[model samples]
Target: METAVKTTWKIDTAHSEIAFKVKHMMISTVTGYFEDYNAEVNTTKEDFSDAEFSFTAQTASINTKNADRDAHLKSDDFFNTKTYPEMKFTSTSFDGTTLVGDLTIRDVTKKISLEVDFNGVVVDPYGQTKAGFEISGELNRKDFNLTWSAVTEAGKIVVSDKVKLQLNLQFIKS
Candidate 1:
């Protein structure tokens, strides 16, 4: 648990979750999660300032708990998984809390900042050094070229353009 030099940590996928919530039918919220993804963190300081992070999520593995809807999401109407199969993020700065990074979706890459809450580090009962983090951000789906939309009979948008991203991450020292 001591940081004498730079340390590397790998995300514990089994204990971490990456999810998004979007407004549905202009009335309700629908939540979805990525089943496949990985991330790595490297740091030179215990406070985590200047830490480096990289993440990748498999587009085809997205799930909204509905198969038909999930298929439609994988089509060109949404993420266009056939054309761009993965979304990636690479951190440019981490000031111990706020993290600025480049997020690439489809074929477009844009800089984004996410608020990070570090939940401290602990040595688990298994004797592994672990850290927990809660990260949240919002992004306009249209900016990533996910411009598909529809209006219902009552004139409500089927899907909202704003997507809220939430991540609960656990990392184990490596």
Candidate 2:
């Protein structure tokens, strides 16, 4: 039997981003990001099959441009950062494409899958090996207990249950 030794990679935060978009009032989209996050990637070969991925984002680092709105998201009605200070994901499988993992938010954990596109690997001028990926998925906020919502007099929903997540990640071999 052939055995493959996995290589570990560290996330290059300066070159990576974790962002999301949610519909507001069933109209425009509100974009946001987690200012602080980290991830680990382990792979047997460049193809990235039999890979392991894990990530965590500081709940308090959530930013939505509007300070008030950001604060509200961190409150008890939403993430309740004080109680659940971090969101996390651990991959169960990756076939060089789809990624299946367990996502935890506000102490609630659920199995979720994200579509992934590998952008190839490169060697930087500094001789650092790096890899890139664009990943996206949609999840219901309510599933993670982010049940806060409001309704206008016109009967419009203030916040939609579904949230769209986008991640542009770059990792450096460690």
Candidate 1 local lDDT, 12-57, one digit each (tens) = 9988999999999978999999999999999977777868999999
Residue-by-residue lDDT tens digits, candidate 2, 1-174? 999888999999999999999999998999999999999999998788778999999999999999999999999999899999999999998998999999999879999999999998999999999999999999999999999889999999999999999999999999
The alpha-carbon lDDT assigned to residue 72 of candidate 2 equals 96
Q: Give the top-scoring candidate (TM-score).
A: 2
In model 2, the runs with Cα more than 4 Å from the true position are: none
- lDDT for 33 in candidate 2 is 99
Error of 1 at 100 (Å): 0.6
For the record, the alpha-carbon RMSD of candidate 1 to the native fold, in angstroms, is 2.4
Report the alpha-carbon TM-score of model 2 versus the true structure.
Answer: 0.98
TM-score of each: 0.96, 0.98
Q: All predictions: root-mean-square deviation over Cα?
A: 2.4, 0.9
